[model samples]
Target: MNPIFKNILAVIVGLFVGSVVNMAIILISSTVIPPPDGADVTTMEGLKASMHLFETKHFIFPFLAHALGTFTGAQATALIAANHKTKLALVIGAFFLLGGIVNVFTLPSHIWYNVTDLVFAYLPMAYLGGKLIKKKKS
Candidate 1:
């Protein structure tokens, strides 16, 4: 396989897996975690509001989702290219984790912000997952 093609595929796989994991964490965790103070914690109400915005904007989530995918895909590609080192994973995870934390704080909605947070929680875990996946396949 060409290195460029392989790299792109690696990124796609990583982004896909990351997005699914992000969604799962967001949906499931929302049920249990209390809303941040001064923010709405009600899932139904929050989702309704989100839907309204999504319906009107029509592009925010898709754009954001794909952007997240792009970033995650890049991370995965980097991880895979790094020869599956835990140290590399840790460093990559840390960068993403910090970036995620910063993003969470910037987001206005408690829920969406937290969704990003949940997505980020997997940064380190994703690296670990990569290690396991790469290990078995190789």
Candidate 2:
């Protein structure tokens, strides 16, 4: 297979894997930590309406979801790409970062949570993921 094609496929795979991880965590988050009373988390409007009721504990899963998703996706990308593994991994991070930024604008949440999620989740995880691959080669 062509290197360019392989790299493209890696990105596609990374995005899919990351999305799956994120959605999976989100799907189970409610079960693991039930939402505040009357906080309907099923829809965007519901989440927005219930945002005020959320506690710090409620934010944990989302942060894990974002971080783990980016980490796994970047790792997968770095593992599969024909070349520029780290760069491809960062691309995955950039993709998730864009989504995180969009989420900030789309939903109202605590500023501290927003800052933390935006600052610490995506790029750092991706870099770690890429770095892990390097360690394995040594």
Highest lDDT: which candidate? 2
Clashes of each: 0, 0
Pick out the ten consecutive residues of candidate 2 with the lowest summed lDDT: 129-138
State in Å the error of residue 114, model 2: 0.6
Model 1 clash count equals 0
Write out the backbone clash pairs for model 1.
Answer: none
Best by TM-score: 2
lDDT of 1 at 122: 41
lDDT of 1 by residue, 9-124 (tens): 65556555556645554545434543333444355556444443332133244334433543454356555653534444444455556656665464444565457445645464
Q: What is the lDDT of residue 134 in candidate 1?
A: 59
For 21-74, candidate 2 gives per-residue lDDT tens digits of 999999999999999999989999999999999999999999999999999999
Clashes of 2: 0
Which runs in model 1 stand beyond 4 Å of their true positions?
32-99, 107-123
